[model samples]
Target: MKKLIYSIAVITAVIQFYSCQKLDIAPISKFTEANYWTDIDKAKLMLNMGYNQMYSAGIMWRDEFLSDNMVHTYGTSDQNSIRRGEATASLNLFANEWKDAYGGIKTCLVFLANVDRVPGMPEATKNRMIDEIRFIRAYLYFRLVNYYGDVPFFTTEISLDDAYKIKRTPKNEILAFIHSELDDIMNRGNLPRAENLVAEEKGRITIGAACAFQARAYLYEGNYQKVKEYAGYLINDPSKYGAYQLFQYPAKKEESYFMLFTPENEYNNEVILDITYVPNLKYWTNMSQMAPISKNAEISADNPTQELVDCYLTMNGLPVKGTGKDPAYNENDPYVNRDPRLSATVVYDNYKWQNKNGSVDVIRTAAGTNTSDSYKGPVERQTKTGYYVHKYYDWTMTPNNQSGLNIIMFRFADVLLMYAEACNELGKITQQEWDTTIRPIRERAGFKVAAALDYPAAKSQGEIRDVIRNERRVELALEGLRWYDVKRWKIGQEVLNGTMHGFRFSGAGGDTDGGYVRVNQYKFNDNRDYLWSVPLTQMDLNQNLKPNNPGY
Candidate 1:
């Protein structure tokens, strides 16, 4: 993918407060007197650029892409090369995101600071823009503190020299700052409903997005009441403020979950805020880069682990409770009753396989299915994970194979889970809570909410909480929330660290060794691994900054 650049130049006889040679270039920037804040159109353009930055090298891919969404444990070569993957400090992106996140926050700040300069800009428009920027500013900083511990806070633009001298603040102080900014946005009535935007403006943030983010913020801090308050508003009147529909199974199972991320459905009611993907938009989505190779094409570097497959609940929406007595389980009843989300998420055995060409192609599901021993005609493209990611695969997107899909950053389903989580933590819910709160999601997923689990069951807080967590993991898999969910709940060891297994394949003149692969499931050997190690360079640049997490 080619690199995309975003900059706003302001001409001035600026003294060197920082060592930023990049900012010292000649006067092509529109921030000058004749163009910039000189008018409303200029201001609108500038503000739009800031938001557009998010879809570029900003928060869209780099920041959220490599996070806990998908676990990558490819060949030994890839694993050994990443220190962060092996739970060490030498990892590349981990050490760099500290600066990357700050760079984005800095850009957002500059846009906000300069908004007033545009002449003839209506007060209402100006205030709305400011509110949006403030929300972004808070969101970026929140991620910084969460991922990198403590780092510099940039409320204003700085030169390279002054930038190096900035010191990290205490974590609490950073949190307080985030709270102040969010509180202001919430009180200001700046955000509009998600449905208000036209087709061209669909991916922009909405009022529900801001409040949903606030609910997450409170969740991280263990502020149950705040989470409940914000999420409650969403649950009671989801149609009015939020947007998300329960999962609808497409005709072909592979297309079932893919609808969520397909470019055609990017602005669907389910998605609140998404990272837009325009094939002609001059930006690169890592989808093609991450997809597996086929008989006639090159495979993606990214591979899924067996652990991820096992995370899928049975057809009945319950964990596949294995029986230790039998080494070989019964295959006759494979699809009997399991978690509904499981089938929608994973392409496992006996299920239909719609070839990339939209034809009902017969693909092997039994053991010894590899054709590495044979030539590359039809069998070469079989998955390495034994199962494939069905969530983002588009049947209509075949021939050209250009993934013009928008990745959802926030959705109404997530809001529902957040509300359920808060309600569970709040002790108990009223009779209305079960019907109005949780049942909608159950009906969407084709699950029969047990009578005891439904409202009037008087279920305990812990029981309801468990149900909510399971629902989220099943429904949101591969959308990119799994790893973070495990870490925040401090269940990495239980969820990640273990021996991963898959079905053994054998047939069609194919023969292979072991044919069985064992991979690492998430688990914590050290407490410090819960939080990512702060980038090593960040600590060296500023002694005042806190050390990488606690253990590093």
Candidate 2:
């Protein structure tokens, strides 16, 4: 796909700070003018700008917490932002989210409505472009309805004076609106795979991509039947739509899935849906923005918490408490033969982490510079959480340079786990179902079939649910999914809002030292810190918007 780079100043000005003062009257022929959508290229540019909104406020930062990638005890200084984010209150960011999404929604609607009016445009091609825009609009509204319980419904771009009168619709009504839009796209039957895009057309919307989101939208809304139906539609008939398939890793017993996120791999087959990144070319990916700064240019910022570490199950397919009887559970012998994912997801002490150039063990000893690979520059240190995130990042790729790894939107493993979770929830899992679906993942990861649960399990589901939950945590950790899983499942307080801890080498002393190094006990916090407050500036803008979660 040909990459288009817009001036950051102009894009931001148009979206967040679009006041009359900055809206200079350009010549009538300028692209920004109201009637400039007279050509095919101009229409395409407008649609591309709508896609860019997904990169800005939509998923990038929000996913950091929503996906359980990281948490902050004291990152922001705005207390009001924090207040509205209290799990029990309304989040201020939540309100801004509505605006951000609607901005893109209006832009898409306008472009789609006006694209056909462009002279010389073929009717067939124009119809395809309209279908793509509708898909994008449906996707934007899907994000809004999921985050905020209810939202204003807008199909066409509204004038400034008419915008304020928009009323909020109930979530169910909004969801129905979304479903209607998706059904229309399906009926239109013109969606294509990302790979089918000619050399000039990479990163445009595809049929498989639309279906994946359709599946995800239903999954998030607790509509399991729809989730299964849509996911099955994509997975069961691979020959018809060959864009997606489960990973097949022959070298390792556990199959590790990989996809394109860089320029070289941008059009690879495995990626179902991903936002593009261009390092020196366009704005680099969110990974570039978020990864820790390193001197060698091979690492980035971001430290995984001990809480996330504990979420992984033992290698034997049991919880830590359940593994107490096993030798690896001894207090004196932490980090022994543990779950394989633990090593894959985190760069813990003494693990041989290999990057493109070579391999290095991450040992953060306070003695000299407690970090791995001195080439990563001074600021690029290993994680403070006593572990490094390896998922979604190719460690071998020089971290300092712009990275190409595509941020994966969805994958087959997530679907399988979701299926097991839904079946477990609805009392639908049979022994045959477990063997056909869940067992393969467990066995591949070196785990035995999990033991059965008691009747209490039936009421709230069983160890099966916990197993699938942990699998997602370990498998999808740092991909930016963990935090949201906590909120939707109502486990955020018990998971994130707790004491954070990490290990120091055996010789260090004090709290900075991993207290009692040989013994891996954790430091602690309270459950009241559930949700994050929306930023304070947003709260000051909208009064009706409330705080998030509960106890701030």
How close is every model to the real structure, measured as TM-score?
0.80, 0.78
Q: On residues 94-203, what C-alpha lDDT tens digit does candidate 1 reach at each position?
A: 65555545545655665676777667777877888888777777776777777666656667666555655667677678888877777677677776787677666666
lDDT of 2 by residue, 70-109 (tens): 5332233122233223332344454455556766776676
Overlapping backbone residue pairs in candidate 2 total 46
For each predicted model, how many residue pairs clash, with residues at least 3 apart or on different chains? 32, 46
Model 2 TM-score relative to the real fold: 0.78
Q: Lowest-lDDT window of 10 residues in candidate 1?
A: 10-19
